[model samples]
Target: MTVIVQPTGVSAADVIAVARGDAQVEISPAAVEAMATSRAIVDGIEASGRPVYGVSTGFGALANTSIAPERRAELQHALIRSHAAGIGAPMPREVVRAMMLLRVRSLALGRSGVRPVLAQGLVDLLNHDLTPWVPEHGSLGASGDLAPLAHCAIVLLGEGWVLGKDGSRLSAAEALRTAGLQPLELAAKEGLALINGTDGMLGMLLLAIADASHLFAMADVTTALAIEAMLGSERPFLPELHSIRPHPGQAASAANIHRLLQDSAIMDSHRDDLAHAVQDAYSMRCAPQVAGAARDTLDFVSVVAGRELVSVVDNPVVLPDGRVESTGNFHGAPLGFAADYLAIAASEVGAIAERRVDRLLDVTRSRDLPPFLSPDAGVNSGLMIAQYTAAGIVAENRRLASPASVDSLPTSGMQEDHVSMGWAAAKKLRIVLDNLTSLLAVELLSAVRGLQLRAPLAPSPAGRAAVAAVTPFAGGPGPDVFLAPVLESARAVVSGPELRAAIEEAVGQLR
Candidate 1:
């Protein structure tokens, strides 16, 4: 599918599509017009011989220095070369693509004063699957994600490295030449225009936000399965109860849980059984509240991400009326805070999931289930160690949940005081995702085992379908085997649309 690049409106899903290389990109006519208007403004600035920040003059800490017209090209080239100071491992290819797309989108908004050819080069690279090699470090996420973006801009100048479609790293010159493209000679304000934006931070945060949303749904599904496996009551998810306070996320979570567990013979049969009494523990009963809090956090994140996605977050924004306006729109605090919030939300999901896993694995805690849900108990050990792994991950998630936004160190000689540390926030989110995925995988395995123990009791239709999908890979309770494959299978069940659709179909019948 072709990914249409509309400057004012792009969805999180579109960003994911471009990152995954499942879509070709096209710069909209409006974006092209914006680029043209911005370029005209830059030209007008040069014509008037006015010394503007990063255009006729130098950049941060050197904004007072003036550049002669004869040395403008050299200055732009030097700008890219000096700013390519990013260190650490190379960023993932998808992240690079996202950064490129964001940069292109920002330019397309027609406020960055960059030439159309440069913007089109980014679009071409995205279409051809050529990704610039951006580093994972070095940006304070203020002053426009400078170091990483400079690496991207270097590719346009035919100076840096690019990963070709064949997976080989080639010189930018060779890659561009092979693709029938020429090097860009940045015009006045073009180098600043290219590198001075929040693309790096925005791109990473956008992808993280999308993944967080998916994980949110997966958390709900897994929580439902865990509740059923524990024979927890569904009365807590009643709509009338949620309707009183009526936070959208809380109501939606209640509805989702209610839908997921609607057709369970096990739940129905136990409706009158007072084995554990009238209520479940907080992890089960308060599932909606905890999970819904994460959802609420995402509502805030969505608003922030939406604004950053469509915003012209560049410095020295060019007005259509032929004026250069320098501003601090490059600051990444907005994205930084959102990423922090996302990390916290993901941590909560992991924490609650760990608690659920604990309850299912404990013989004392679990009612009517075999010790550790193992057939032999003493010999097999069942999923005993798996709960330990889940606990470890949950503990680590707590450490990872520490807000990266609150910790800041001065940079660029205190010129960049109060850094956002958004890169740290985004990086920690990746860790949070890993922990959440593993925790969910453990819960899935335990829940399926619990369902097996229940036998003829029959889980809810949705739960049964979920178990059936994983049944082939789920061997009978046996010796501690390598769980990597099991985890992978569980991930497949969680991530695959078909599996989710099957569950949804089963639930629909219940309704």
Candidate 2:
């Protein structure tokens, strides 16, 4: 589908579509007007021979230096060349696309003084599936993601490397030429406007936040499935209990759990059974509270991400009335804090899932399931070591949860004092999400095994279908085998559309 890039606003869902290659983009007419107005302001500044911060002089610590008019083009080219200092592994292609989209949106707002042709080159690159090669490091996330964005800005002048549709690296000039587009000249204030922004850090964090939000919902579904597998009570999910305090997230989580477990013969049969009495432990009973907290955190993140996506985060914003005003909106502390919060929320989910995995494996805690859910308790180890793996991940998450935003090391000889380590936060959040996914998968596998041990007493319709989806790959859990395939299959169920549809269909039957 063609993705419309309107100047009205950009959404997290739009970023997801663009990143996943489901949408192509075009600039809106409003964006063109905004760009033209900003460019006119830059032209007026040049005509008056005003000494703006970056337009007529050097940047940051070198701001006092003057530039010769004859060497302006060389100065702009040198700025891009010297600032492409990023290191480490290249960023993912999807992230590159999102960065390009966000940069276009910010420029389209017209405060950055970029020419329409420069902004349109980014749109053209996206439409033709050409992504620039951006490295994972080199940004302090203050003064904008300067080094990484400089790499991105180089493509506008057709000077950097870009990956073609077939995955080969070609010069940006060659890539643009092959696509029937010419390189753009760096106009007054254009180079500074292009590179001075927070899009690099914001793009990565936005995608991470978006994925983490979906995984937060998936965590609720998986946790409810584990709760049912243990024959846990429904007292904790009652609407009356949550309605008294009524946190939106907590209420929604309770409703979701109640819907998932409704109409189950097993739940009905155990409602008054003395064998499985009044309540389950906190991990099973207070699932909503833990998952709800993560949901609330994500809601806050969405607000912050929305603002960053449309904001003009460059220095020296050119006003439509032909004036150049320098500003510091390029700092990334807001996104830094949000990314840290997301990391903590993901850590909590992993911590709870680890406890659930522990419950399912322990003979003393598993109620009636076999030791480690093994058929022959004495001869087989069953899922004994699986719990150890889950525990190790949970332990690692504690370290990952440490906030990267709170720590800042000054760079550029203290000119950039109090830096925001938001890129570090974004990178760490990605790791935390991966770890959480594995922990959830392990708990789901263990829960399915425990449910099988309680045969004849059927699980809820959603629970049964979830079991069926994993059963073909989960095969009875004997001696330790190659579990890589098992984990991959479980992740597929958690992330795939088919499983979501099955869960929704089961919810409809329950209601």
Q: Highest TM-score: give the candidate number.
A: 1
Q: Residue 488 in candidate 1 has what lDDT?
A: 80
lDDT for each residue of candidate 2 in 1-511, tens digit (9 for 90 to 100) = 6666665546767777888854888788887887887788777777677788788888788787888676666777788888988887777888788878888777888888778888887788788777887888898888878888888888778888886566666798888888887777886667777788788778888888867876777787788778887778877899999999778778777888888887777677678888775778989888888888888888898889888877778788887666778887999899989989999998998899889888887888877777888877777778777778889989898899999989988877677888888878877888898888888888878888877767788888878877888889998646656777888788777666676578887675221
Q: Least lDDT summed over 10 consecutive residues: which range in candidate 2? A: 502-511
lDDT of 1: 0.82
Measured against the true structure, the TM-scores of the candidates, in listed sequence, are 0.96, 0.95
List lDDT for all candidates, in order.
0.82, 0.80
Indicate the worst ten consecutive residues by lDDT in candidate 1.
502-511
lDDT of 1 at 169: 68
> Model 2, residue 87: displacement in angstroms?
0.3
Angstrom error of the Cα, residue 151, model 1: value is 1.4
Task: Please give, for residues 287-362, the per-residue lDDT of candidate 1 as tens digits.
Answer: 8888888989988988998988778788898876777788888888888888888899989988998899889988
Model 2 residue 88 lDDT score: 71
- The residue pairs in collision within model 2 are none
Q: Count the backbone clashes (under 3 Å) in each candidate.
A: 2, 0
Over 4 Å off in model 2, which ranges? 164-174, 477-480, 509-511
